[model samples]
Target: MGVCTSQNVQEKIDNIEDDYLKLDFNRFSTYQKLENIANNIAKQQQVDTIFSSLIQRMIASGQGHILKILENIDNQKKLGFMTKLERLDFEFIDSLFHHCYKQNQIDAFQCNVIQSTNCQEQNFDLIKEHKVGIVFLCGGRSSRLSDKLLSDIGLPSKKCVIQIMMERLKKILMLSSENKEINDYPIAIVLSDQNQEKFQMYLKSQRDFGFQSINFILEKSLPVIDCKGQVVFEQETQAIMTPEGTGTIFLQINSFINKFPNMEYIHFLGLDNLVGLPLDPQMLNLISKQKADVLCKVIETNSILDDRIFYSNRQFKTMDEQDSNITENSYNSTQMLLNDLYLSVSFLNNLKYNHEKALKLNQRYHYIKRGSNIQFEKHIQDIIEVTDITILHQTEDYALLIDDPRKAVIQLSNVHKRYLKLEGTQEEDLVEITPQMSYCGEDLRKFENVSYPLII
Candidate 1:
């Protein structure tokens, strides 16, 4: 008898076709069919040793009945033959199916709901004492914003969105620190593969904005899956792929958390919202005091049309009352959780587990087509149902979230206009409209007093 080497087994497996196996299964006995399929899978995938060992153990333990069930199903026909990377991708999608839950079913606990008006000195003090981290979700393709991140919004400094954010961080640390030296809190900038190099160069040119420590977590890209459920290759060697969205931060922050033992809560913000205070003391204080697992910041819309969707008792719904004169009521404006949140090392660890589970179960995988390629992505808010969440509301006038490029331009123009007015200078004279220079107003509002700061 010849010894069955991996090379020989692989050659045999490769010769076996799906149609041949299907026909063989119908004609063979259960045990024969099981043995053939297992051998093929093991041989082609280079897992013959593990597969054989498991089968032998199962047979020795009188659990061979399991093999009978395996014979009735065709693994290749159902799952398709996958490469190592493809297998990993499928496993991740499978886990998502288990963790996915209905977003509307999340329970909103209202105990000790913290408000901007109620935030006091004690809360600020608590915020200063607690160790909190900020995760900036900035590495997106920015295709909607013309592939530039607020590059058109700054003055002579020509600061990009990241530079503006770093400046804000410096201000927060300055205010919170007792000593003159700035306290370097852990900051994780989650970037996509495309933006990682460019953003790093930008930060280096600016001297990291006086930040003592910053961690850049570049998100991993997965192969694009076609309608036939096969990996789509862009070139002969390269597969078409995309970054897995903001939720990927949950997977990338483990090392950051490990390095900063004092870090308790994580605040997530998008780069577009220049006025957002990443480390707002009052918000941090609220999260700490309430012992909430998740915190969502929202603003009440002026009318039903403004708030097409609203949350009632933790359930999200479209406003049935469409009267233009409806009384003052809070409604959901954008799916973007501006000033969105997650917490404590323990909570994050758990979130990571749930996130992976959701991915494996196919719960959060949103399949969409980008031109000729198919992409799988997940939103950060998809995890809300699986988490304990609390919503903090602000008035619509006080909140600003930029979703459109035109709106962003208008908002920044308003800021520039306000700056000219405040400085007692006409835009025609003091402000230069050169192609190279653009100006956004300085942020003057005290962080503790506002939900979303008004830039002036």
Candidate 2:
């Protein structure tokens, strides 16, 4: 045999891992499967009070099975037989019970501490003190984007949304300037296994997006494949299962941080957010200043039906074939899904994190099953269980109709709306650059671009 080169070695490594990585859809350990259901119950309880109106409806209809399990658990202790195994089950389930049912009881005693921290409006500087960062849930199968990422959405200009956002970020916040970065200012994107080639092209063309040296790390995709070896998704009938959640972006961040010692905050953006206002420097600076740990984009929608699917704290063995058969929710304190939320929950390195512990947690599964049932057992809570959760509200966070420019939502089906202005044009000159002007790079000066989303 010829000597194996680095290319050959890597290909072999990938092939071997790919074979092992695709575990059977139903092959979880018995203990692990039980753990998933138990955790989801806790997730439901955690959000119950805040979203009681919607959650009450979810439990009544969506969670008929989980609710009965919790009811059975509620009565177990009163009967008085506490074997170690039985006690472990009760105790684990009870931990979720309290996370779900009892978090509301805090309302009764009502200390200002919880109130001060939860859904509270915060300034950027003030939020920095709270150590809020970002997690760009970027990993996805870019099936919508044509063979070339830049060609997706058929823009005459070949810029994909991520590149467009980066260009905007660079001008607004001076992000790509050799040393002109906010200390600890991190911008992370979770990548899917499918689009490495497309993303690599981006790295070649627009390397200034920062995080260049170590920006693109892989997120582990959950197991869920068809007989023909395709992954399944609810959105489309024959799609492949990529990384399960944008939440996994956090895990990739934690892995990358060991090298970048000074990094602090995170600004997590969806890779495919065209309406994302990444081009506005004013917006980027404002977000940095506001000190948001996790900034969520809110578009005003007329639909009255609940767009937010309230998750139950329980594990679901995927009896249905959607994106992934399994979903994870709540866990007892002992069996916490610590890293689940550590990926999404933003905080500073002021507190050293247990990377080893996180690795152990990643071995377990997370879920989103057959009938839109989601299990959120392990979450940002295991680490940042939010002694208080603050939702920052800012009217200043609005984007104007820049050219009335709009694109169809790529990730979600049939959803159409105006997006935040990634390609920022001043009102007087709110004109699209012709092919010639865009290619020349002279048109760059005409358009005022920024990284952060805070725009005037």
Q: Which candidate comes out best when scored by lDDT?
A: 1
What is the C-alpha lDDT profile of model 2 across 1-456, one tens digit per residue? Answer: 787674664464344334333334355563353343334433533322323332233222222232333333433342231121121222323333334333433211111110011122223342233233334444553433324335444333444555655555444333234325543344555566666666677667765455434356665544343322222334222223444444344445666665544444444555443434432223334435444332233333333212122221222121121212112321111121111121223443422375654564343233323343222223332222222222122211222211222332221111111122234333322233332122122214422353321222
For candidate 1, the per-residue lDDT at 347 reads 70
Give the root-mean-square deviation of each candidate in angstroms: 10.9, 20.1
Model 2 Cα shift for residue 69 (angstroms): 35
Worst 10 residues of 1 by lDDT: 432-441
Clashes of 2: 70
TM-score versus the correct structure, for each prediction = 0.59, 0.42
